[model samples]
Structures are given as structure tokens and as C-alpha cells.
Target: MPFTIDNTILLFSLLLFIGVFTTKFSARFGLPSLVFFIAVGMVLSKFIYYDNAALTQLFGIMALIVILFEGGLQTKWRNVREVMVPSLSLATLGVVLTTLVIGVSAKFILDVSWLEGMLFGAIVGSTDAAAVFAVLGNKNIKQRLTSTLEVESGTNDPMAVFLTVSFIQLIQSPNANIFTLILSFFWQMGLGLALGLLLGKIAVWCINKINLDSSGLYPVLAMAFAIFTYSSTSLLKGSGLLAVYMMALWVGNSDLTFRHSIFRFNEGFAWMMQILMFILLGLLVFPAELVQITWQGIALSVLLMFVARPIGVFISTMLMKFTAKEKALISWAGLRGAVPIVLATYPLLAGMENGHLFFNVVFFVVLSSALIQGATISPLAHALGLSQGKKSVVPHTLELVSMGKTNHEIVEVHVDEHSGADGKELRQLKMPQDSLVNAIIREQKMITPRGNTRLQAGDTLYVLARKGQNEEIKALFHQQVTEQDSANV
Candidate 1:
């Protein structure tokens, strides 16, 4: 059978369908969706040959841009603000520390040259945003711990990219000064940070002011600027990944036109990017080649999980307010995914002596991390007494798409079994003057909220209220603490 453009489209569509469908099993089996996505690619690898490292590398970059931007957009600023200092510390210094430990340890364990070992360490140094976000999606851990890990994963890529590129240069030129490279790192980071913030503020202003003919154009405009931010920063010798992430963070947190619509669109787009990236990486692997690196990969994975990551977390978070348990969970949650495999392609693209070896080893390590650490995060959290249990699933969802700047937003308030407002009629409750119940969701059915309607336990209220009324609204609906509850606390 001759493979034509039609055939390519058909295959691509089928892969995407399977990838999306794989999430059901992920939820049912308590594994990360990425694990299933990659597995599907590997299972089909024999039939579909994909050995283009350069093309894979390009796709990886595009995917990461969308993923990071969407992640930043969805994250709340208040959550990130409290842990910014520690998160940045872990994202920068912690990455460096992890790389150093793994590099030094690999020199002896893998019996490789100093440069090669360091190169390997740099490849897998940063925790993957896709993996972290996917695993931690609904796992109700402590807010501080979650924020720290999320911010760290979202921000650490630039350091890994820098270290990987610098080491590749050192390997090619052997006489390059380490001091000069270290200085270049600072220059790149500083410029990236400045450009990201500048462009982000400008982007937000433009978004708020521009009135396009079609509302759909808003998201399109945002997407174009996001890519431009990365390219423009990179062309000027800055950290493109960091610029993209910071830019999205600023834009996402700002009050802009159709903010909810833009967020929803970007989120779906990010999922497609994730599926494409993992499947492509999965197809790149050959089972025959991976067998050769099994022992080496396992050894390095153990070292990274147990030694390198812990040391990095402890050292980076020292003097901070995190407990030992919090730090331990953070260390264990550093699961590598597409980013490390993407970095592995660097040596291959550069045509290094051990290019193939580098790619295979890194691929094995990533698979191991995703399979082991990724699968066990929830159980480990529970055992450490840090798990808050899974979040209650709401059958219905509500979103407020703003047409223009407004102070009103939709908030979901859940009624507990014996909450303050559980048995009260909607008219009897003391709601803020500006607040209105949009709808009541109970037992997976939507109810038109009337003044005489009584609020039942387990009902989810979608209330449209002005921004400042949340505290009063929550207080009215929140379950009051009784003597028994106080005793339990």
C-alpha cells in the first residue's frame, strides 16, 4: 500500500482519537494519562517508523510552548505569589544541584567521560511540566506544596536548556571556558525575564483594548504573540521557554476581554500538543535498542529518585518553611517526561560521538521515571500523611465568558450535609445584594433556582456575584463548626 497524504491524515486522526480515549483507563487504573499515551505510541511503533530526530526536536519545542503557556494561564496568581521565592530557588539552584549530583555519580556508574556524564545529567535535570500537571491534576495535596511544585516545574526548563546547550558546546570545543558559559547563563536568564514581563504587560494591554470583528480572533491573537515571544527572545539569545511561560502567566492573570473563552481554548490546544509530543517521542523508541540500556537506566533512575532529587530539594529548600515530609514529596514527584527526551535529541542533532547512546539512555530513564514515580505519587502522598484525598467531582460545570471588562464572575459554592444554608429557601438566605444564583446542580441534574427553592445538601450553586462578595457568600453557605468539629480539630 502506497502511503499518501490521505493516509497520513487518517493515521494522525486515529492516533489523536486513541490518545484522548486513553485518559479513561488512566483515571480508572490510577496512572498518569501520559503513561498510556506513550504506551500507545510504542505499541504502534513497529508499524509506523519515525526516526527523524530533528523534526521530533522541533515539534517538542512547539508542544512545550503551548503546554507551559496553558499551564501558566490556568494557575492562580495568589497561589503562586506566596511560594514564589522558594519555587524560584528550586527551579534554578535546585536544577543545577540535581544535574551536578547526577553528572558526578554517572561518571563512575555509567563509566562515561566527565563531559558525557554531565551532558546526560543536564538532559534530565528538570522535572517535566506535562508530567507534573497530569499527575497532580485532581490529587488534593497541600496548597503550598502543590504551588511550589507547579511553579518549579513550569519555570525550571530554561536552566535545563541552558545547561544542556552549554555542555554540548563544551564537548564540541573542549577549550571553552566554564566561567564564560556561566556568565552567559545569567545574561540569557536576565534578558528572558525582562522580555517576558515587558511583552506580557504589553500583550495584556493590547488584549483588553482591541475589539476584533470576531471574538474567535482573540485567542488567535494570543497564540500568535505567544510564539512570537519565544522566537523573539531566542533570536536575541535569551531563554525562550522562560519568556513564553512568564508571558502566559502575566496574560492569564490579567483581566482581559473574553478571558474565560481564551483560557478554555488554550487548555484544549495544550492537550492536543501533549498527545502529539508523547506519541512522537514514543514512536522514536525501538525496543531492541532500549534493552541495551536497561541496567544503566535503572541505576540512574534510582540515583535520581533517591539521592539527586532529595539532595537538591533539601539543599534548595533549606531555611524555608517546608516540612521534611513536604520536601520528600516534592523530591519524589520530580517525574521526567517529554522534556528530557527532547533534550536527548540535542546530542543527536549535534552529531556527537555518543549521540545514539545518549538518546537511548535518556529515553529509558524517562520511561522508568514516568512508570515508577508517576504511578506511585498518590500512594506515597497518603503514606506521608500529606494527601488531602481526591477532589469531589462536580457533574456540571459553569463558566463566565466576559465580553468586556467587568467586576462580576461566577463562583461555585458547595452545600455540605448540614451547612448553614442547606435547608433554607433561596429568598431567606442573606446573599449580597449584587449576587444571584445562576443555577443549582444537584444529583447531576440542573435546577432553575427560584426564591422558594430550598438548598439541599450536596447541591452545587453557580452564583454570579461581584468580586468582593465572595467572603460573605461563602460564610453564608459554609458549614458552621459545632462542638464535635472543634473537639476533632
Candidate 2:
């Protein structure tokens, strides 16, 4: 077949399908699905014409926005509430610290100038939410640990982006004052925070009130709102990525119509974005350049995964009560994905020092991080004894799409013979503040639940929880804690 435009489409279709299937066996080899995507891009780079930096940068940004928004949507707020300070600190201060350590290390190891090294460090600093989320979707973790990792990855991007852009500007204008840059940092983050919260609330309010006739339209509406959040915040000199993520988080947690459908749609959307992004990024590179940076790239990758990430996590959680084992797992969970490669384009676009080399190095570092860190998360979690094994999610779920804007979820949970739920009265389950057992099904018969009613071993629970309380509601039907619940991730 002649490699025409039609052939190109067929090629991509085949690769993407193959890529999706390949992830099924990714854990066996201890490699993330992203490595294959990049490898595919490198293999095809010789056959394709993908030398447009500007276009690649544009698409990468778009993909990242969607990816982060999807990260927000999948996250459950209630799970993270208790660990808010640790999560936020890791996202903000932890990112800055990691960037600095990596920048200095890269400068000396790579023999690069300070600005160039800082730019490289900043680009690769934040843990990629796409990688973490994709990996953890298959992971069996405790709820708090899962929430902490998700929130850190989701929120840290703005800081990394800020540092990347700031370093680029410094290189361009050698006379720029350090104090001014510091001020700009705070200004951008502050405005982004305020606007993100405001826009999130506004979007949620509008989404709940404007009951659309078609359920599918709700996802479309939510996507449009996400785009608006990003664009508007960026135009106002704030962190658009942060704003978009915050907005999605609020919408996901709110009493919006068609909430379940939107979540499912966005999850699939996130995977597609990851595919497009890694493939495009792969096409942008020359495989030969990667060889030049191999040893150096591997060294930097090791520093990032083992030294910088652990130090950042430890410092960020200093005031908290985390076990040493949990901290170790958190450190290992830092998987770098396409975000660094995407940020690599910033230096290239800015015509900064060793821009091409930086891009290639960042690319290799990401591949290393994903291959080394991504693959090891499960094993490390197990070895550390921090792996809580999987929680009991409501199997055979049947969610009722917002009969109309209400902040409640209809969840169906099975109470197996081993579950703690077997003999507990409704009030003794200690469900979240507003959650209730609306009904029960036992022996193929439905029964309306009352507060004093006792549950049975074979009962199926019909629960109504306030929105974003999926974690809280699941606890009611979970089996009693046992020592041997091995993690499957």
C-alpha cells in the first residue's frame, strides 16, 4: 500500500488499537504503555513529516489540558480532604524544590549553563498525572494514598510550567531581576487560585441549573467549560492549566446532571489524549539524538526518581504522620509522562540554549522515569507494606443519572459473606454524614431500609451518598480488614 494520507490514517488506527491492547500486558514487563507509544513514534518518524515545533507544542498543550481535566474528574474530593495540607504542599513547594535539585544536578552532570539546566529541571519536575492516573487505575491502593498522589500530580503542573516559562524568560533577558520573577510567580499562582475557585463554582452552578434535554450534551457542555476555564485564566495572566483542573474537579464533585456519564466519557477522553500526545511527541523526535543523551539521561532520570522525588515527598510530609514505608511508595510513584516532553517544546520554541538537546534529553528522561518508576510502583507498594490492597468498589453498579440536579449518588453494593456489613444495623455502619441505605435486596426480594434494620450476609446494598462520597459509601459494605489482601497492580 502506498503511504498516502489515507494510508496514514490506517496506520495510526492500527497503532492506536495495538497500543491499547499492549497495555494489557504492560505490567508483566514492568513498562508503561507510553513507552510503546513513543517507540512507535520513533519507528515511524523516518517515514513521516512531523518537523513542526509550533504545531506539536499547540497539540501537546491541548492534550495536557484535557488530560489534567480528566485527572480532576476521576479524583474523589472526600478521600483527600483529610490530607489536604500534605497534598497541596507537595504540589506547590515540593515541585519547586524538586525542580531546583534536578536543575543543579543536571547543570553539573550535563555541563549545561544554569538557565538551560533550570529549564530542563522545571520541565521534568512535576510528576505526570496522566501516567500516575493511568497506572493507578489498575492499581490497588488505600484511598488516602491514592487521593494524595492524584491531587499532587494534578496540582503540581502549574508550578512546573511557571518555572519553565520563568527560566526561559531569564535566559532571553539576562538582565531580569530575581525579585521581579519571584513576584510574578506569586501573582500568577494567586490569580489562578482565585479565578479557578470562582470559575469552578460558577461552572458547577450553571451545570446543575441548566438541565439539558439530552444526556450526552452534558459531557459536551462540561468539556466546553473546561476549555473556557483554561483559555480565560491564561488570558488573564494566571495558570490556565490549574484553573481548568480546579474547574473540572468542582464539576466532578458537584450535583451536576448526568454526572456518571460525564465521568465515564472524560476517562475515555483522557486515554485518547494520552495516545495522541505521546504519538505526536514521538514523531517530533529523531531517534539518533536520543542515543547521544543515553548515559546522561539515565543518570538524570535516576536522580529524579530516587533522590529528588523522595526528598521532596519527605519534606512535604514532614509534619504529617506517614510511615516511612508510605513515604517510600510516594517517592517511587513519581512517574514522568508526556508532560515533560511537552514542556521541552517551550525551550525549543523560545530558542533557548541547547534547545534541541534539552528536548531530546527530556524525552529520554521521561522514557526512563516511566520505564523505571512507573513499572516499580506496584512492587514497591507491596514491598513497603503500604499497599492496602484494593478496596471493595460497588460491583454491578447501577447509577441513576440525575433524575434532576441533586447532590446524591445511587450506588449498588454487594454484601458478601465475609463483609463487615452482614450484621450491622443501618445506624452502626457509620456511613458519611448525609449518606443513607435507601433499600436492600436479599434472596431476590427488595426491602425498603429503615434506620434500625439489620443487614444480612447476602444482602445487596442500595445506597444514596452525597456527591463525591464514593469512598465514604464503599466503606459500609467492605469486608473486615485482613492481613493478606494482596495488591493486584
Candidate 3:
């Protein structure tokens, strides 16, 4: 049947339903959800004639903005700060090294020009934030390892973006000034950082000061500013993606109203964007085209996984305190996702003659990376004795709603066997003066706390406490209590 607005909506909704449903199988099989979502797009490609590259590009950018912004929101400033130096080195120098190595390899394998080969390298250089975040979900991985990977993935995109755009310009005009390009990269990144900080401060102030009748509108206000930050930054010749992530990092770490609600809303929203991004990318290509470059794609993928990425990690972390195994895992964990496929579209849109080849090859590399690296990261971590094991599943959750600025937060504390408060009555525990046990959850059941109710191992406590009392309250609940410690409290 011919397309109509009603039928379009019907078809789109059906596709989304299938995409969301695919998550179950993804979890069951221990595969990245991107695999299923992209497969759905490819299968649908046979029945649906959606080959609009421009539309895919537009949607991809919007999706990345939301995804990165949500990433920033979830990241803790202290965690990022601790690993800042090494992560930056990986994001910048690692990307450049990876690009050069892969570029040189592709030059020989594909018989392409140095610049063209490097362009392909630049396209796939950065480890994707979406893929990294998804694979590392709630894993009991060591904090240092997790923080390094997360920070690196979040910060590396701008470098890849710069390289891709610059190489495209050079490919078009071989005589373009190298110094001018270098200056441009610094300007874009510098302005992006400044704008992100400025807009983040403005956004937090607005969210706290503006009292909307409906609580829901606060998130809407935040969403609006997020989009504006990206577009406005790009319009001024800055790196919009970096700006979006930076703005979110600041907002997420700052004290503000509806902070928890804002995070919850964006988390769901970001998932939606991820689904759409992969599917759209999947729809943009023909599987038959991928077959033509199977050998070449696999060659580049192997080179990237075995040689390029490893070299990048080793050289980048050579001075850092990471162990041999940690660096090795970091190398293997550099899985590609939507960002690469999104970046591949740049060559096509920029009028590169072999753009389709670039896109198909990048698509193949991502699929292989996700399947190979994504599937094995957990087991490898376990094998290396770096896995912290999975965190406990807490069925019930609590959030504090704030209509204005407040110092109160609902913090979750787990009572393990080692905790001194595990067998003590609620009234006997010496919590901070302003803190209160709001509720307790055990075995998925919520229980109202009474003065005489005893805490048990495996219980989850929702404690409402002042902002600065987190360490004290957590220690009271989780640490071993001695006679002197109790007396001091």
C-alpha cells in the first residue's frame, strides 16, 4: 500500500515494539542490544524502501546529542576527576595512534590513498559511549577500570569527529592548509568547553529558580536546553557533541531541583534514541553491499582489534599505573557502535566517491566488534580476576522530590553480612542527626520500619539524609562497629 500518515505511524510503532522486545533476547543471549536492533532494520530493509541518507544523518545527530547528554548526567564528577589525566591521554593520543595504524593498514589492504585510508580509520577510531555504557551496566567491575573506560569513551568522540571532518576536507581539497585545520580543531574544542560550562550553569539555575505549576515541565525545560546547547554550539562552529556531554556532566553533578526525576526521565529517553539510531543506520545500507567487502572489512576489523587498538591502549597507558591485564582488557573492550556508523555517513554526505564502501565496511566492523568484544568482556574480566561480580538486585527504589533547593537526598544502603548494623534494631543504630530510615526492602517486599525492627543482611535501606552526610551515614550502616566507634558516634 502507498504510504500515508496513519500507516506510517502504525508501521513505525510496530517496528519500535519489535525493537524494544528484542532486548529480552539480547539479555538472554548476552549480546549487545545493538545487534538485534540493527538486524531488525536490515530485515525490514527488504520490505521497506527507507533509504533516505539525509534523514538518517539528521536523526543520528539528534540521537547522539541525547545519548551523550544522558551519559554526562549519569557520570559522577569525582569519578571522572580521579581518572581525568589518563582518560584524556587515551581519548586524544589513543585516537590519533589508532587512526594512524589502521589508516596505514587500510592503505595497503584496500589500495587507497593515505588520506582516504586514514579517513576510514578516523571514522571508526573512537570507542562508542552507547556501547561502552550498555556493556558495563551495573557490573561489579573495579571502579578504576570502569571509570577509565567510561571517561575515555565519553571524551574521545570530539577527537574522532575532528579527524573525520578534517580528513574529509583534505580529501576534497588536497592543498588545504594543515595549520589552519589544527587551529580549527583547537577553536572548536575550546569554544565547546567554554559553552558547555556556561550553558550548564545557566540550565541548573533556571531549573531551580523557575517554579512551574507542573513538576513534569522541569524535565521538558531541561530537554529543550539540551537540544539548544547542541545546535547553538554547532552553529557557532564548535563541537556540539562535546558541549552536550559537558553540559550534562555539570548539570548531573550540580545540586538542583528535580535532579532524580530528571535523571530517570533522560535515562528512558536515551534508550529510545539508541534504538532509533541503530535501526536507522541499519536501514541505510544493503546487506548485499556488505558482502562485497566482507574480506576487506574483516581484515580491517582484525587489524583494529588485534593491532591498532592494542597499540593505542599500551602507548596511552604506558605511564599510568594500570596493570598489563587492565590495559589488555581496555584494548579488547574498545567496541564500536552507532557513532562509527554515524560518522561513516559523513563521507557519503560530503560527496566522497567511495562513501558506500566506507559505510558498509564500518558497519561490518561494528557488528563484529559488538559481537566479539561485547560478548566476551564480562568473562574476560572474570578470568582476569578484575570482575567485581554483579551488584545485588534491589526491587524497590525511593526518590526524593524537591519543589525547590534542598539538601536532603534519599540514599540507598545495602546491609551485607559484614555490616555491624545487620542484626541491630532500627532505634539502636546511631545514624547522623538529620538522617532517617524512610523504609526497608527485603526480598522484593517493602516493610515499614519501626523503632524495634531489626536490620538483617540483604536488607536495602532508603535513608533520607543531608547532602554532606553520605559518607557518615554509609559508614554507620555498612562498616563494622567497635565499642569506641559506637561511643564516638
Best by lDDT: 3
In angstroms, the error of model 2 at 368 is 0.8
lDDT of each: 0.86, 0.81, 0.87
TM value for model 1 = 0.92
Candidate 1 local lDDT, residue 408: 74
Q: Per-residue CA lDDT of candidate 1, range 293-343, in tens?
A: 889888998999999999999999998998899999999998899899999
lDDT of 3 at 99: 98
Q: Each candidate's root-mean-square deviation in Å?
A: 2.9, 5.2, 2.8
List TM-scores for all candidates, in order: 0.92, 0.85, 0.94
lDDT for residue 263 in candidate 1, whole number 0-100: 80
Instruction: Give the per-residue lDDT of model 3 (tens digit) for 299-393.
Output: 99999999999999999989999999999889988889988998998998887888888999999999999999988888899999999776654
Evaluate residue 10 in candidate 1 and report its C-alpha lDDT on the 0 to 100 scale.
Answer: 90
Candidate 3's displacement at residue 387, Å, is 0.2
Which lDDT value does model 1 have at 467?
64
Off by over 4 Å in 1: 392-402, 405-421, 465-489
